[model samples]
Target: MKKTLIAAFICSLSATPALAKTEIQFWHAMGGALGEKVEDVVAGFNASQNEYQVNASYRGNYNDTMTAAIAAFRSNQQPAIVQVYEVGTATMMAAEGAIYPTYQLMEEFSKGFDQSDYLSSVTGYYADQNGNMLSMPFNSSTPVLYYNKGAFAKAGLPDRGPATWAEMEEFGQKLLDAGYACGFTTAWQSWIHLENLSARHNVPFASKENGFGGTDAELQFNGPVQVAHIEKMGEWQKAGIFSYSGRTNEGSAKFYSEECGMYTESSAGYAGINANAQFEFGVSSLPYWDNAIETPQNTIIGGATLWTLRGHDDDAYRTVAAFYDYLSDPVVQADWHQFTGYLPITYSAIKLSEEQGFYEQNPGTDTSIKQMTSVEPTENSTGLRLGNFPQIRGIIDESLESVWNGTASAQEALDRAVSRGNEQLRRFERANR
Candidate 1:
């Protein structure tokens, strides 16, 4: 009877199932090599714990991923986490109950979470009016100048990037004289030329502190500084010294192919540029117009942040909080900063990278960080909060293209862009309100 009872107990134990882990879905927009890195990071996080499993999915590019999230939210199938680009900040902020603010998420589930640990320049972009962070900053980057060192040497120019717009023009001429078909090219035309340009010059891209004060702000980028820069770029386009690539990152190919001697693009482009460029390249701070301001203000960031969405259970949110904690580790962040060209979002990650001598070994890797923290960000330079900014960017792109192709003057194009963009802002205001 004892043997039979023991056998029955063993059978019952064998029939019982082990506790299943909570699965969390994270949707992101990082593609190509960056996509692989995201998977690796997610894998590391998964390996670190057994209570939850995180499945990272590359939905598409930034806009597509954000659209998917919104659609999913409407259908009651949103993921726990979604990566939304900086341009989508205003849209996400106006989503009301659609998102769970990162600040609140951390406060509720994380222990000893300190918001001050993150870089202010980065977190400031995604923060609410009260200074609470709305989304978790990730893959933040600022624009910088990338020069072909080999091409510079061949052109008999200095081994450094141009410091000012005038100097850049001179360098472009020299590069052209040296037989380069294109002297310089830029990616994200509106972003690099108008948005960052206004911020660096301490000019308002829009009224009411660039929309941070209220949603009723209007576009103001047609000011003197912005007009002059675009006019100069138009002249360069006419002279064949500047190549007008598409509105997005299509200009990167012009640089990678060594047809252009200088390129202005996001610091996050380091990985791809490093992989493709056969010749040596150097990174420098984004060039400014000496006449714009005596000293340039800090530039704004252009990258995506992780926003925790609604429609998930508390257990899933707890898992997300745990994953965020893992992501905040200095070692993990440092690795990300080194491998990718994105800024280390936290001060500890910066220190850890410094200790590891990453900045020393990889020259110019800290250029973006330096440019972003070069000065105390003013009301105009902190960041933009304009609604429908992505569509507004499309307007700016069309306007700039008209100038580049010689169909419109700088002032006219910009004036038109401002007028059209304001309409977008008004529509967004009415809808969101």
Candidate 2:
């Protein structure tokens, strides 16, 4: 009887299942110092509630993260949340039944829905025609002018940052004359040169809502303003006013080492920059074209948003929604903005920072936000919403590379880039429609 009772108890215990935590896996592109901030946000969310545990994973860069999510979704092993870059907006939207819209997710799963809390400019980009926001804008940023103070001093130029592209060109030439290897270099050349440059000069990169309204829109990057800027940059190149760093921001190493006078990169570059710079530096509004039609419209956001993936259980969705709420909390959001160079996606976070004198203490840190909000975002100023934008950007990269290397003239390259990019859009439009 004793052995029987003992055996029965052991069997009962063996048959019991382990208690499961409502697991929420978040796949993101943030790595290096950026990955650490992501983990910190996840940890904060996990600690805020025991009902849900958010597990953050770094999947690679933006493209890699999206590719992994698609594969995972196809295999029914997708995470509750996946962070995708701004370029992936249309692709994510086209992936029918794959993502749960953030506004809808907030209502279906959480009590923490506050659409009014988000910045109008940031959230408006990921929204639909009727102004319904889809993804939660998490790490929104714009390109800024990052100048090496040391380079300016060495060039005998005032330690002040240039306010216009013409001024920037002069400054760049001065640095080159002073024996600097490359006076300027940048990452995301298309983003800096074409998209942001277009908007900052109040020109359109495409028609039909910057490719948002319809996928059939063609790239108009060869317009007079764009062509002029490209040709000017090309002329500067031949004159040694600018230098090629590489295809991508990989050559951004020159800027980080204080070799370049000015570097145009995403504002999210702050963490790596703050850690690596051997000399003092500052940021300014991205230099604009002076005579180009009404300059300083608004810069488009870069970075990514937290896209909630489907095919997960209710428990998983609930956890993901709760994590989003946690990330959107005022204190949490404010800390994120200050800690990273990313813009606070919420209005309250900006107000809180102002109340706390965060911006007052840190001059130039708010330039991106100010530049974005300086004017009401018309259809043109809001942001780009292109299909296969990453691929199109690559075409631009090739065109620009040719111009820089003297293989193709600016107008010729841009015209060709537009033609090839429109073909890709035609493909996307056919499939989506």
Candidate 3:
């Protein structure tokens, strides 16, 4: 009887399961198709390992996610990771004690991380003054031209996109003459027309190297080049060659609906435009000012990156680092890039895509990569690292809306934006200091 009871106890002990895997929460802003891709990436990671499980929560858009994460952190319930848009870089950088630098985390936990493998143009935007990466470059992208090939063919315009602003204007005029609703429209007017325009022209968007040098930097976007460009856009609006779509990617609908022949938007616009457009379309490099004194420089990055928040356990940090390393795999990076139209963040990923002939098979898909990496990034072209940039973008949007609606001239409107933007910068400087 004693031997039978001992055998039963041994059997029960052996049948017990092991402990659950450590859970790591990731709060992000991606939604829709992009959100699905995020889930796939996380699932792949979870399947590849048994020690950690990442739970991804869609917190809303970029602004909303940032706001939510900030609230969560203050309440000591922050996620292990948060994805913040480029506009929030300065804000994140300012939150020194609340976040973990990705470089240190990678070095301490990701045994295979190679900082040198990352593309400079993509990493530079999120790096410190000494070039140490502060966040993982998850979905870096730049503005590009998305045009309706069918509309261009109907207008007797070049099937390929225009290379210069003058060419773009001429194309717009021809498209309008051919009975299109409008020649062109844009999605992110402030980003595409002003911020990137200044960078592409190697002109200063703000003092102190576009605010990368210091918080004391003031707005310098109201200069002659910017004024001339805005004036030209206004002229196009008046001539019916350009239509003013509502702010915040509202113009994408206009282009996809074939109301406009051309659109300047984030290269990530590919997925949505491809999904919606009935007519054939092509992606191309952003048009530049051909008459500028200096040749057009590289455009700046616009997408968000993943940031590791502080206060997590060592185990969670290690898991977060492992996930970061997983995300940096060449195959994973290339798949994400091709799937979403974001630039490949790592050189290995770009080379892998080339090895697979992804670019050749899909014409014009490499437009964003070429536009970003063709030239060495100058100080002006590296990127804007301004604080309170979201608010500044709002101010610029409001001011430019007045310009588009003929309530004010471009120069007058831009002057007002600069004046208003400078005050915001001052506030950020004070708060951060």
Candidate 4:
């Protein structure tokens, strides 16, 4: 009778099945080391829980990933979560019924979630009119001055980045005299040169407070401040003080190669710059036009945010909220911010980082943070909300390239870009309205 009972118990145990974990799909634009870090983050979350498994896919670069998500949404096969660049905020906001607002998702599913916990400068870019956050802030960055310390020493200049455009010019001349092939170059010419430049100078990039007011807003970046700045860059190009690397981050290579003595790029570029540069580098605040403003205002961000899409079931969304909650933990955020050189999104994360001595040990790592928080954001510095912004950026890129190549004057190029960009705004308004 004992043998019979043991056999029956074994058979019952063999008949039972293991529970399956719910699967969540995540699409992202991060590649290379950042991509590896994304995978590790997902693995950490998966290991921490048994109820849900997140499968993160590297779709491509920012534009490609966004395109893929839109295509997938149209096919009814979209991922549960997608990372969209900061510039895409307006387009995503205009996509009615496509997004599951982060505020609503967290309020409904996650406990102890406070929108106030996030940095207002970071969240304000992704928030609605009522100040409700639409997406989760991830990898936020602002442009800063990156200088080759070795070159600065060689040039007999001070061991610091230029505080104003005039100082930058003087530093550029000294760098050139020090035998650097290029004195300075910048990534994302439109973002760093015109957009943030205008904001720092308290000038409008477009009317309607840079389109935060409504879709009827028009381009106003061709103002005197913008035109004069571009004209100065054009002159620098002629003088070999400024090299036109490209419209995007191709300029980083110039800095990495030590061909350019100084670079104006995203703070997140620290990861690559630190990894590749054989010599030491120092970071500082983005240069401003002292003549335009008595003091520089806060610069805008340039990285991406994570947006939850519609069409996912409640269970999947619950898992997403859980994942987001995990991601928002001060420890987790501090780790990500330290590893990636992105901004710590929440005050707690910043405090945790400070307590960890990450900034003190890293030296210039806190420059971007200080540049962002040093001044309260003005209406011009709050953030841009232009529609079809990606396309508008392309227009501005072409126009700037024309100036760099000496084919058009600053006034002519900007006027043409403004005209062309306004057409895109009109088209975006018609489609979304």
For each candidate, what is the lDDT? 0.94, 0.85, 0.92, 0.93
Q: Which portions of model 3 miss their true places by more than 4 Å?
A: 1-17
lDDT of 3 by residue, 150-191 (tens): 999999987799999999889999998999989889988999
Clashing pairs in model 3, backbone N/Cα/C closer than 3 A: none
| Candidate 2, 1-433: lDDT as tens digits | 9999999999878765344568778899988777898888888777776777888899988888899999999999898889999989988888768989988888999896888878888988898877778999999999988888887888899867888888988898899889887777787889888988887877788998787777778888899989898898898888767777776677568888767778888887776677888888888888888788554788888888989887878888888788888888889999999889899999888999999999888777898899888888877767788888889988999999999989998899999999999998998888888
Clashing pairs in 1: none
Q: Across residues 1-433, which tens digit of lDDT does each residue of candidate 1 receive?
A: 9999999999888775465688999999999899999999999999998898899999999989999999999999999999999999999999979989999999999986899999899999999989899998878999999999999999999999999999999999999999999889999988899999999999999999999998999999999999999999999999988999898899999999999999999999999899999999999999999977899899999999999998889999999998898888899999998999999989999999999999999999999999988789998899999999999999999999999999999999999999999999999999999
lDDT of 2: 0.85
Top candidate by lDDT: 1
lDDT of candidate 4 over 1-433, digit per residue (tens): 9999999998778764355677889999999999999999999999998998899999999999999999999999999999999889999998869999999999999998998889888888888888899999988999999999999999999999999999999999999998988889999999999999988998999999889888999999999999999999999999889999888889988998999999999999999999999989999999988888998999999899999999989989989999999999999899999999999899999999999999889998999889888899887988999999999999999999999999999999999999999999999999999
Which RMSD values do the candidates have, in order? 3.2, 2.4, 3.1, 3.4
Full-model lDDT, candidate 3: 0.92
- List pairs with backbone clashes in candidate 4: none
* Model 4 quality (TM-score): 0.95
How well does candidate 3 match the true structure in TM-score terms?
A: 0.96
Off by over 4 Å in 2: 1-19
In model 1, how large is the Cα lDDT of residue 263? 97
